[model samples]
Target: MAEPFSIKNKLTLMTEPAAAGHRMILSGISLRTGGTSRAPFASLNLGLHVGDDRENVVANRRKAAEEIGFSLERWVCAQQVHGTNIARVTGECAGAGATSPDTAVKNVDGLFTTEPDLLLALCFADCVPVYFYSKQPAAVGLMHCGWRGTVRLGAVRMVETMCRTLDLVPEDIYAVIGPAIAGADYEVDQTVIDEVSKLGRGIRNGAVTPHGDEHYLLDLQALNRAVLIRAGVPQEQIQVTGYKTSVFPELFYSYRKDHGRTGRMMGFIGMKNKGEGTS
Candidate 1:
């Protein structure tokens, strides 16, 4: 693989390639360096629920849509309650969560669709942006998994749901574990570690490490990867970007690092219109 993601424009970190024909996975994770918001938000805030000015957030979203080549109207968003709830949407659900958070697919952290040209989006600061897709049926999914979502096996749920809905086996799914806080930066108390430990030693062995004083360093990417592997997604097919959002202040906003007052980046995944593209 030759770098699964790259900086495409001022607004997004491109992934998979957006010019590989109709079946290409057209998706991008917004960077915090552009747009109109100021100060705490100071630019590129794709989340409306955050305290940023609505107009500025909308403007930022438009910029992202334009750069990613996905129409703003065809986009579907979720309120992201940090749960494992995944919604399967279609053309009829177009524009569900575009400008307003209220209209976003109510309380879902994950969204998927086999229909083309419909983008599924969610916002993030430090949480994992788990992307899923399968070529045979032409589908894409985006999920928000924080420690809570990960402990609940959100990645496995998404894979299982996609497999069940598409009538395919887990091997058919291709997963991407996008940017998020790295283990060195994500220390959790015993409560969190205890839940994670329940995931079995194989999963916990690579993801959870004692941080001293009852705290533990948790590698969310590894945990999600382990669960996905358990769900039957081939280890080789799954890609972990190794991009840590918390470490890049100029390029990303970290809720934990920023002390809860910061802008959000959009994680968008969608299939482009026919002949309209991604790699």
Candidate 2:
């Protein structure tokens, strides 16, 4: 498993040699980080709707954007509804949801754009953060995939959107499965098991296993990878971090581990300015 380098205090960055110069990151929970939100939603919480102080969330977002060489004005995000809907971001949508939830691209879980300098971001605790980039078109994308989004095949939707809107083919696309709860720490009820089982044999193979009492452990990373492969993304073109949020409290926030009283890490991807170098 490849590790994201910590730029400062637990905030980390994930980059791939294959993606050329695209920037992708998975933030960590660290007190020294820049947000002013208080305990529980402490320090670096980038989520605006998670009961954190609005001012603090904004400050944290500004700091993250600056660190990545993106201005707050160019940061684009969405109101993640845990669905498969994907939005094609453009210059007009830049800065939406960067400071508040109301202005976000409504009810969407995935955001993609070919526009340079537009930073696409999404919040997550245990939900899988899937990233997409294409060298051919110089495009990038980010998706929030929880159990609902996974069963709905959010990755496939993002691929299809990129194909339709950006004329990108799945074979030319590169993807990364960022940190989330691992199978060992994630237990689901029979309802979730049934829904995931409907995804097909390729996805069901090692993705779900029986736990005591009508409950099962689900591997969201594996499930999303399978969906991407089925959508035409080659296996070698994808990267899985394998970093389980539940197992690393000091490094990340986990909704299930903290019983819903927790902050969220940010997953971001964007193309750099034409003359700018990778950070």
Candidate 3:
């Protein structure tokens, strides 16, 4: 989606000023971001909770972090529940909190933090992985959006969460809709089609596609983009990957592709001011 990460793609990795303090690395076994495991998990698997060997996942994360100049320990992960819950991360929440003994600060699908050097990660298979960064507020956020979360206005919720809590305007924020199940492959029943169809005309027209009789294919990315626009983000300010996760099995792990037995990939973001650590 983002210009098909080429052999020269590595040069464009750190081009975004918003990503200067942190690296947004997407894996490519060939030309796409595929997990490095094999068979059910293939290579590049980044999820530890999916029955993947914890040690292997850890090793994969280590390489990803090292490629970007961050400690594998500095990247943080969350326990997601497909809800619209958004957690505000602080300096105290650094590193993967999955195995943390503390339970007081658990649960959430989206996370935001202004802390420099505190990277944030969220695991995804087919769900739309959304990343938000504000050049104005110097804050970053990650969200996992599926059909359930999308219907709950998860992307809009993330935007509102940042705008209301961090004094950020929608225009000042830039968002990217990462690789996910495109409409052509995401067939849904009439009930679901109806539910999404009711979400105003943009979704009904721009994101929904017919699939023979009682089924329909939904474009979660376009729907999310529409939600962002309705929430006040300028069209140009938002970037959509539009990459179909299920299409490229080698580069990405798709629950649909593997019948729900696949490992997950981590989409993360972190930021610091220019004068702070060089991300």
Q: RMSD for each model, in Å, please?
A: 2.0, 2.8, 3.9
Cα TM-score per model: 0.96, 0.91, 0.85
Pairwise lDDT winner, candidates 1 and 2? 1
| Of 1 and 3, the candidate ranking higher by lDDT | 1
CA lDDT of each candidate?
0.87, 0.79, 0.70
lDDT of 2 by residue, 12-44 (tens): 554533334443332222222456768898778
Q: Give per-residue CA lDDT, model 3, range 127-199, as digits (tens).
A: 9888787755577788889998997899989889999988878887778877888678888889877778678
Clashes of each: 8, 0, 13
Candidate 2: pairs in clash: none
Ranking by lDDT: 1, 2, 3
Per-residue alpha-carbon lDDT of candidate 1 for residues 93-112, written as tens digits (9 for 90 to 100) = 99888988888999889999
Measured with C-alpha atoms, the lDDT of residue 131 in candidate 3 is 79
Return the candidate ranking by TM-score, descending.
1, 2, 3
Cα error, residue 6 of model 1, in Å, equals 0.8
Q: How many backbone clashes are present in model 3?
A: 13
TM-score of 2: 0.91
